[model samples]
Target chain A: MTILSFNNIEKHDGHTIVFPSFQLSIESGEIVGLMTSINVRTVLLEMLRRKIPVPDQAIAIDGKSIQQLGKSYHQRVGILSIDDGLYERLTVKESLLFYHRLFDSKLPIDGILQLTQLEAKRNVRISKLTFSEKRRVHYAQLLLSDPDIYILEEADQNVDLETKRVLMKVVQELQKNNKAVFVLTSNMDSALAVTNTIYRLDEHGLHKLDVMQQEMEPEDEAVEEEPIVQPVRFEKIPTKVNEKIILFDPPEIDYIESSEGSSQLYIKGDMYQSMFTLNELEQRLLPYGFYRCHRSYIVNLQKVREVITWTRNSYSLVLHDQSSIPLSKTKMAELKEMLGLK
Target chain B: MTFSLKRTLAIFQKDYKDVSKNMYVSFTVIVPLLMAFLYGMQGDMGVDMVYTVINMSLSLVGAYIQCSLIAEEKEKNTLRGLMLSPASTLEILAGKSLLTFVTTILVIVFSAMIIDYQPENIVIVGVAIALSTLFYIGLGTILGLVTKSVMEASVVIMPFFFLFTFGSYATLLAERFPVLKAAEYMPNTQLIELAKEVQTGAGFGDIWSYLAVICVWIAAVFILSYVTFKKRMMD
Candidate 1:
């Protein structure tokens, strides 16, 4: 049965109309990809918010007049938004717990946590966690909701190969459970890799590629052989295997830097932002008063004000101007010692 | 009811938690405390009649602060996460209002204790406070929901704080100023009269007419707030 279907769906903002008309559908156990280079994620979120209604000829969620359903519509729809405002100070477990409350009575908590491999980092705060870990937390929250339909936006951003494998496993599990998956991406590779059913969107419109029925055969082999030895590549002494350095060929530090109180960081490379872990970065920059105040953030010591204990040594570090950074329970004493508070 | 109570209380607790951590929220609450302390020392410095105007004025300020708090949350896009949850808009509003009401109650209790203003009829005093609170809180919610940003909500409500405080204070001014004497017909005057009568241990009979006015006003404001909330939720 079709979980969601949209036909001749048109949308308009107060100023302009974007999608003149669009058609889409998802059945149980199907993996669908909505591929548009434009800002489709925002539109989909708006449609989910019902700020923009679905097309007139569409059936959404059990063919119910979902307009009346209100928040219940969210029950069967799990959205992993690339634009989700991440509360970095919150622990991975705490973050999941917050969303779990909303999605309660829908999925078992333990199962969701296990599926996302976040059980180990349950106590680790997100600011202290890795980018991949944060993405895992977001994915876990979505999966734990156990929605019949899943929507992902730029989902591959933080995912490492292992995490991607886990997510694909999750997609497989959801499909096995008859849940429908819908992923949206600007990356053509991700679009092809994750889904069989592709809705290729452009200015003209969307092209629904029927890869599932094997209508489009594999066009060409993607891999082109790299020469055995390019002089510069070999001269670079491929000795140090740093992902960022390896992936991005930069001879030196080229970056746009921004400061958050004591913390100073730069966005390097044009494609993506990069930074060492606060833990790793803090060690080299301790003389600069840049200390690991939170797991995710290394604040400049100049910003540290006073420390207030949250619940039972779940400490909160107030900045010079009284802005607060959360201190994990485990790191409270270490932080105190580091700051000479002890 | 369970969701309302649980979610409201949870939100209220978190507001306090956020308050404890945020210097700004702390500053807001502490400013009143500090002002109340400063005001206490200047005993009878031409302000003995403050008890007459303080109640309603404080109530409005309380409500405005409450509205702005939620307004900030909305501006942060933080409310969307809660709005998308199982907590319906009603529950969310209830929760927001509950947080505001609690803050209001604390400020009132502090004012009463510090100012040495005690009413004769505690029940009537309580009811008047409750009604007066509900009226302005509903106003705050509507304003908060409609505002484009936190700064906008505050500016939109800035006149209200003055109107609610000074406008209602006209009830007490009626005794001294002839112009304000005409305010006896105003609903605030009736509520103030009710507050005064309660202090004198008067019966509810003396206040029933004003209570009726209070009821009509409350019903109207509550309806407006409900409609605004429903519209925002739909959006």
Candidate 2:
């Protein structure tokens, strides 16, 4: 059952458009993740929290319009934002009991403490707890609310491995109770680790991410020498900004450099991290006027304005942005042959 | 909007625990009682001296404490958590204000007792004190909503604190400076005036104007606070 949904929603700040129209639907007993930037997350969370009022039919809870449901809609949907904001002076049990009464939740306090694995810390003040332990108190508040749909914003961010495990376990527990969970995060790895139903939202639109392909990457590399699978060509190179995957067209990239065994794509002075190694990126970008000018660099031939030979052993390729990339002495010969310049 | 005593009391109880543990805010409740005791040592307490202590309580225990509590919520971003909870706006505001309200009244009663100051008309003075507490709470709410942190709230509340706590004394200079005459209309000044009238055995009908002036301040401050609270809710 679809517990919460919003469709064709548009948001703007003054004359600028924040996010274009998009639709999202979360079904019961499922966990979904949306990957986007912090700016987009702020806009999206506001829309989901119903702070930014949409048109009459834009948002719905339990298949009814949110405006019609009014404040009662909040009871069905609870948002666990990055800021847990627990009272620092209160004990864990005291804080949980307060929310339990506020939301009129029937869940026992001990049950919540056990679920979040804070039973030992129940008597500890929030000010005295660890960062992750405080986050567990946040999860406990969510359980105390016991809403049918839980909207989590970066629930796994900046926590220890144990807290991450506890968060995942809590989501699984919610799914067991047939509750819907929606996670909004900028970290692609966090999204993939939490659930398979992940989507990436950007200025373009919302696109479903293929988690199967992502998980199969390591296996694909392991089986590469066997040649059992055919080579697949991709025109768009995927790079990441703040853990969000952004697919960039080959023409938009100025150069690619390998740093610490990972590929970095440069475009107009801004660096974006790519998951592909330098060799893989070189192979994929070769047809798009790109050449491996150095062991650590691949320069786009179209953007190369000048090739400076400082010495017989030292060479550089200068692009239109006035940024120079190193050119290997051997690859200098290859570039000369490709450019038909002796 | 739904009203739940269970939820309100839960918030009240939570705030009670929170305030008791926060020495920065909880210790402020003792200021007025201490002031009253010092005045009692000097001999019979005048109505102005008694009101001086009561007005200090209104600004300190009422406005300053309420402002710190709400600002602390915003500072820690806990206000958003409460706003998103199933509890209604009324429940949260009433629940929070109830603590400050009770504290303000208790301090006022203690200050009155410490100074051996008795009102000829307890009903009239009680009503005035209650209205004045509401006014201070409303003022505190507005300050809390405008400032993002408790530090900012303390800074922003300085002028108002002086004006509300000592604004009544501005009337002492009203004859020297014609512009200072407006201070006579301030709620704290009206509170002082109301207490004086009641001491002279004035009935509700005899002192209705002073009560009405304080009521006007309450209505204006509450309206602004409610609007500010609504705006902050969206933020």
Candidate 3:
């Protein structure tokens, strides 16, 4: 499957054309690297901005015109800018939540928090954090959004060798999951590390180079330890699009069946309240916090830090981070009774 | 929830953070507050203090803030990060201008409240501050686009700050010397309009005229700055 295809893509900036004509595409489950001089970074960024669909000619994706699928293209396409695009005021978690809202779905954020190894620093402001730490948060954000086509600009610029390998492993994992990766690298070595197909964007235009198949031949890595297996292939399995939306599975509430025959808990944030269905959630969370706080919602008593009285007839729940969730009139008394707050 | 809003908020929050930590933050918040007090104390200070501080608060401070923001980001190589997002130049400018406009209004309110100086038409005063700040922020953004460092932002902005202080000569001359009528468009013009509106309860017609002038300036400068920024992005 062709996840991304750019044909005869030209970009102009009033006076002069930045990219004259470019043609490129990445196969499904392939990680292609784009190597170019540092001078081209600004122009390339402009190309993405203007989305100059044709280099004065033509550009398309999966045979559909780029002009037709413009913003739609962006839905599955994520661009990692030259600077990591970290909001300094946002703690790592807030940053993730902010981007999560854009995906039109609430994500299981804790996994990404842990995957990026920023859990310990989750609460710290990004501005006060170190460069590498900030970059980690940046990468984590890109991952959590989970785009099928990720355009990474200079992915290996500031990290250590160990971290670079970890990032490469991540790209491999993404590729294994059938995501097409477009990497712009100034370092040919870094570009060669993760890519089978490589291209160069230069004065002429974008040139698709032959795959560096010499060293990457599959048979060369035959180790006695185990067969170096290729990634699993589902022939004609269809792209992630036209496929069912996969809800991100996060850790579910783990609770023992209470001897008292009911489990009540507190889970805070408008985030959870919106994601869980009151009735269906009631069945799944019977052993947990699925206590009917009101007709509109349920609460996990364990997650609540305090109950805040909003007004004479209204109240809000204050959770761990001081984030509030509204309680319906009926839910409040039930919640209060459950907590013996009356 | 669309990409643009997410991107816009990201830009907004990021710029907000950058400004909050700026050493100049104290100057922006404190200078207006302090000078507003000084303007109220006509015993030791004269109307000149009122003119200079109030003028600078509404006009120069926002420009300085915008200039400093661009310079700081350029120094950190962070502007390139924002340019690469899938947002149009208008969206970026909208977010930035909104931040600049809101912060500028804060300075205006602070100065107005502390000095016991009220505008003839509060709405016109609002329109004036918004237009003037928008104009100046656009101006400051152009300065930021042209410069290399945050400190350089001060150099470009200081002359205007000084003008609003000494530019009163031009205003005094405009009062008596018809030859100085040519200089009315200088920094003194905005201050004179504001002073007239504040003291004499002038009609909103003048404020509207001034706002139109400021709007034109903002539009011209914004287009120029955007072109410059875009050219830089293509570099």
lDDT winner among the candidates?
A: 2
Candidate 2 per-residue C-alpha lDDT over B44-157 given as tens digits, one digit per residue, 9 for 90 to 100:
867888888898999988998789888898899888788788788788888989999999999999888888888999988999999999999999888877888878887887
Q: Output the worst ten-in-a-row residue range by lDDT, candidate 2 chain A.
A: A210-219
DockQ of all models, two decimals each: 0.15, 0.79, 0.10
Relative to the true structure, candidate 1 reaches a TM of 0.66
| Candidate 2 off by > 4 Å | A10-21, A53-56, A62-68, A213-291, A296-342, B230-235
Residue A314 C-alpha lDDT in model 2 = 93
Lowest summed-lDDT stretch of 10 residues in model 3 chain A? Answer: A236-245
* C-alpha lDDT score of every prediction, in listed order: 0.64, 0.86, 0.64
| Candidate numbers, best DockQ first, in rank order | 2, 1, 3
Count of backbone clashes for each model? 10, 0, 11
The CAPRI class of candidate 3 is incorrect
What TM-score does candidate 3 get on C-alpha atoms? 0.62
Q: What is candidate 3's lDDT per residue for A1-342, written digit by digit as tens?
A: 887777665655678655566667787788888877666766665455454334422544566665565455555667777664555666777767755654443558887777667788888988888877777777776786677788888877778765676678778878888988888877655676777577777655776644324333354334746865769631111101111111211122211122133322221111111233346556655554545554544555565677778797888765555655566777777766876878
Stretches of model 1 off by over 4 angstroms after superposition: A8-23, A39-45, A55-57, A68-71, A86-95, A106-137, A157-173, A209-342, B1-16, B42-61, B168-190, B230-235
Q: What lDDT is reached at residue A272 by model 2?
A: 78
Give Cα distance to truth, residue B43, candidate 3, Å: 3.8
lDDT of 1 by residue, A1-342 (tens): 998777666656676665567777889989988766556567766777667666443537777755766677777777777756454545666556656654554577778778888888888766677778778877886776677888788788657887887788888888888999888886645655566567766444666643322225555454334445555522110111122122222222222123442223421112233344435445555554455555566555555667787679578776654556677777787776875878
lDDT of 1 by residue, B122-197 (tens): 7887787778777778788788888867578767876776666556656556667788776665455566767767
